[model samples]
Target: MLIFLDYFLLFFHIALTAFNALGWAFERTRKAHLILILLTLASWTVLSPYFGWGYCPFTDWHWQVKRALGEGPLPGSFIKYCLDGCTGWDSDPVTVTYYTAVIGVVVFLLSCGVNWRAWRKSHHTQSSEIA
Candidate 1:
């Protein structure tokens, strides 16, 4: 059961990371995606600093699972950890945070722009139809 929980958290972490980074490409999922992004930003920016500035609850939870299962030290970010595992690139936590923040902001802005354009286009179409 503990092993299963560990893997589940790992996969869940990966999915959420990817969704935050790329989910904006899908029109149908953008609304929920943006909300999740906002929640993530708030947690990282406004929450208590016990876990540090860019603390991720999911990562903290996963670390608990690892500790319970007697696993070794966990990585800073899931994506960076995976990259290190696959490509053997030793990246520091600070670099991981920098890359993650940049990517997150870019993806978020792109998502908002896409949603805004769609909203404007629909509004214009409706106004034209009424005239």
Candidate 2:
């Protein structure tokens, strides 16, 4: 189970990261495309728990296994925090707030950089024409 989760996360992250990265690679994304990227990030974060997410969801899933099998770090006779959502850790609200913020800023910056370059070129052309 843990191995499977890890594989899933890796594949999803790589694909989505590449999707957004390449979209911004050639040029700055238009307002609509930028919004779509933001939405994708938000969707990943908000549905992370249900979808299994983060830089290492597999690690977390393994932790649960160790706890159940009576391993270290968990420090308990039994029970695990691995499946928080299913095991009643839902009260704490498993929100991916941090990643959402990080991704949002990153996406926004890329958008700004692209727009800035385009604007600068336009301005230079206009100035040259006037001269």
Candidate 3:
């Protein structure tokens, strides 16, 4: 069961990360993308002082499962772990963290911009109809 959970979390995290990055592109997912990106940013910034920078509860739980599965000491960044596993490249943790942060912020801003534009469009349409 633990192994099953480990795999579940691995794929789930990957999918969530991908969604957080690109979900804003779809009209159906823009709102959810904004919320998820905000949560991700909060996890990285608001909770950083208490949990350290870029802290994610999902990552924390996944790490616990991995540790229970007898994995040796894992890297601090989940992205780093995934990159190393997928590409067989032992990338630097600092570089991974920096890129992860930059990409995350960029995605967040994109999500906000798209959502705002969408909201403004709908709001204008509604006002025009009412008039």
Candidate 4:
């Protein structure tokens, strides 16, 4: 069960990370993307005081499972873990964190811009019709 959960979380977290990065590109997912990205940022920043910076609940849960399975010490960054696992390159955690942060901020801003434009366009259309 724990092994299954570990694999499930690995897949789910990767899928979620991909979505958080690219979901805004699709019109149907823009709002959800914005919300998710904001929530991610909040987790990293707003929840940092208690959980420490760059905290992710999913990662925490996964790490717990890993510890239960007797895995050795893990990197602080999940992105680094994925990269190292997938590419066989031991990435620097600080560098991974920096890139992760920059990418997150970029995606968040892009999501906001696209969502705002969509909302404004719809609002304008409604106003024009009402007028």
CA lDDT of each prediction against the hidden true structure: 0.83, 0.53, 0.93, 0.95
Question: lDDT by residue for model 4 over 1-131, one digit each (tens)?
Answer: 99999999999999999999999999999999999999999999999999988999999999999999999699877899999999999898988999999999999999999999999999999999999
Query: lDDT, candidate 3, residue 62?
Result: 94
Model 4: ten consecutive residues of lowest lDDT: 72-81
Query: Which candidate leads in TM-score?
Result: 4
Which of 2 and 4 is the better model by lDDT? Answer: 4
TM-score versus the correct structure, for each prediction: 0.89, 0.37, 0.97, 0.98
Error of 3 at 71 (Å): 0.3
Report the C-alpha lDDT of model 1 over 1-131, residue by residue, as the tens digit.
88998889878988998899888899898888888888887777777466677778888888788889887777767667778878899888788888888887888798888888888999999999999
Report the C-alpha lDDT of model 3 over 61-87, residue by residue, as the tens digit.
Answer: 999999999996898888999999999
Which whole-number lDDT from 0 to 100 does residue 124 have in model 3? 100
Candidate 2 local lDDT, 93-119, one digit each (tens): 233344444655687688667767777
* TM-score, candidate number 4: 0.98
Candidate 1: clashing residue pairs, number: 0
TM-score result, candidate 3 = 0.97
Determine the C-alpha RMSD for candidate 4 after optimal superposition of all C-alphas.
Answer: 0.6
Candidate 3: where are CA atoms >4 Å away?
none
